[model samples]
Structure formats: structure tokens, C-alpha cells
Target: MPALCWNQRRRDFYAITTDVSTEGIRFRSSSRLSPGEDLTCSIRHIGLLEARIDRAVGEEFTVSVRGGRSALTDLARQFVALSRAQDLRPEVVRVHHRIVPKQKIVQVTLDGGLGVSGHVLNISASGVALLVEQSLEIGATIQVGRKLARVMRHFTHGVGAAFLEPFEPSAVHEAMTL
Candidate 1:
């Protein structure tokens, strides 16, 4: 499963889990971490956890979870359930599923109160991909519809942005205007 791990310095890195259990988790990361280093790990759908690195060999590392056993057990179960559910569904490349909105035209507000009209290519609870004529710089803060978002990536014809505050998963729908 995909996971995000943050070092004590607050730098985040993407990781993939090789093994998981109530006691500890083993994963591979590109971030160089020493044994005994502390980390904050967030597993999708499983929430965040505090952990201490127990061992590190190349890119693989094992971390002992620091928390109540019951909480760890619950998180482990959730991970397993979600992993299984993912296997049953079609392969999903993105973190969140996107839907086309009925209203494709939207107003994108720039930082200085400048608003430009754009087309919504697709939207998810976390972010939106929009086709705009104006060139937007990556990392610029912009308002998509009514939601505040930050540009994360730029495509040939559009820009991808992550919402500053994510919407509820249930709130995303085909008929919704945002």
C-alpha cells in the first residue's frame, strides 16, 4: 500500500509497504533514515501513527509502532480490509477518483482578485484538473469555483491543483457545480 512518511525535520516522502502488522511495519522508502530515527507515518484510510525505525537495510526499513496495541490492531485491520477492497476493484492510478461535473465552465480566482474563466476537465475531493487559457505557475494559490486550491502540476492544456481543504468524499457528485 502507498504511504507517506515524514521525518523529524517534517520532510515528507512517498513509500510503499512491504509488510504490516500490529507490532510493526516494514516498508521501502527513498528517504535515507537511520535506525532509531523517529517518524510520522500516514497510511491511506488507516490514519497516522508514530513509529521508531528498528532496522534499515538499503531502501527497506522496519519500524516499531509506538501506541496502544488495540489502536495498532484496529489500524492493521483497516489496512488489510482496504488492501483487499482495492484488489477487488479496477486498478486505480490516482489517490482519489475523479468525476466530470455537469457544469464544465468555472471561474478561477487568482491571488490578486483576478478571476479567469476555465473549464473543469475533472474533479476529485482532493483536487481539480482545469483547462485554462492563462498560464498558471505551479504552487500558485488559486480559487477553483468556491474552493481554495494550490497548483500542484501543469499539463499541456491544464493545471492540476490540490484543495487547501479537501471536500468530503460524499460531497463529490456529477451534478455538483464545483
Candidate 2:
């Protein structure tokens, strides 16, 4: 499954889980990480977890999960359930999972510098769903907080905009402004 990890510097990188167990998780990441490094990872179907790198061999690394055994067992169970669900109905899974933002109200700026206030319904690495009064045309370029995006679709309450460039999965969290 897709995974996101944040290094000690708070920079985020994308990763894919190759193996998981109550003891640790092994993943392949494009970003080079050193052994003994610390990371905070968010895995699909599993929430945030703290880990320490045990070994790094090129793109593959193993990290010992840092938490109680019971918690790890629970997370392993959830992973099993998610794997079964995916095998049963892969089409039902979303390409990019949406997460609710802690700070929903955001300032949106149009091409001409027109500013509008909007509320974030949900956000993902690729795009955001928002509730705004302004009727924006499809393909309209706009800035949501610090990121530039283009309107992709319209809904009853608002519009869906895809980011010009995808954000690091860990960057779209509660502490972020948008």
C-alpha cells in the first residue's frame, strides 16, 4: 500500500510498503534514508506511527515499529482487513485518500487577484474539495493558501481543484494552513 513518511527535518517523502508485521515494516522509498534515522509514517488503513530505521539497502529499508505490542497487533489486523477488501473490490478504493483538515476555512485567490473565502471539505495529495460561493469555471487557475491549483470539477456546494503539482502526503496534515 501507499505510505508517506516524514524525516527528522519534517520533509515528507512517498513510499510503498513491501512488508509489515507486529515487529516492523519494510518499505521501498525513492528518497535515500540512513540507518538509525527516525521517521513518522502514515500508512493507508493504518494511522500515524513512529519508527526507527533498522537497515537501509538502496531503495528498501526496514523500520522497527515504535509502540506497544497490542497497538501493533491491532494495526496488523487492520492491514489484513484492508488487503482483503482491496482484493475483493479494488475499484472501490480511491487513488488518493482524502483527509479532513483541522483548519477548514481558507482564502482562495483567482487569476485576477479576486479573493474569496472558502471552506475545505477534504484534501488529498492531488487535489482538494471545497465549499465556496464563487462559481468558478472549469480549468480556472487559483491559489489556495500557498499552493496553486486548477479547478477540475464542480459540485452542488462547491468545486474540486487539482494541485498543479502533487503535495507530499505528510504536508497536508492538521498543522498545515491549507
Top of the candidates by TM-score? 1
Candidate 2 minimal-lDDT segment of 10 residues: 86-95
Q: lDDT (CA) for every model shown?
A: 0.88, 0.88
Candidate 1 lDDT score relative to the true structure: 0.88
Model 2 agreement with the true structure over 1-178: per-residue lDDT tens digits: 8889997686899999998776578999898889899999998768889989988999999888887677668778888898887777445345677888889999999999999999999999989999999989999999998889999889997999999998988776766676
For every candidate, C-alpha RMSD to the true structure in Å: 16.7, 18.1
lDDT by residue for model 1 (1-178), tens: 7889997676899888888775478999887778988998898777788988889999999888887677668778887788787778566368777999999999999999999999999999999999999899999999998999999989998999999999898898999987
The Cα error of candidate 2 at residue 110, in Å, is 0.6
Q: After superposition, how far is residue 104 of candidate 1 from its true place, in Å?
A: 0.7
Clashes of each: 0, 0
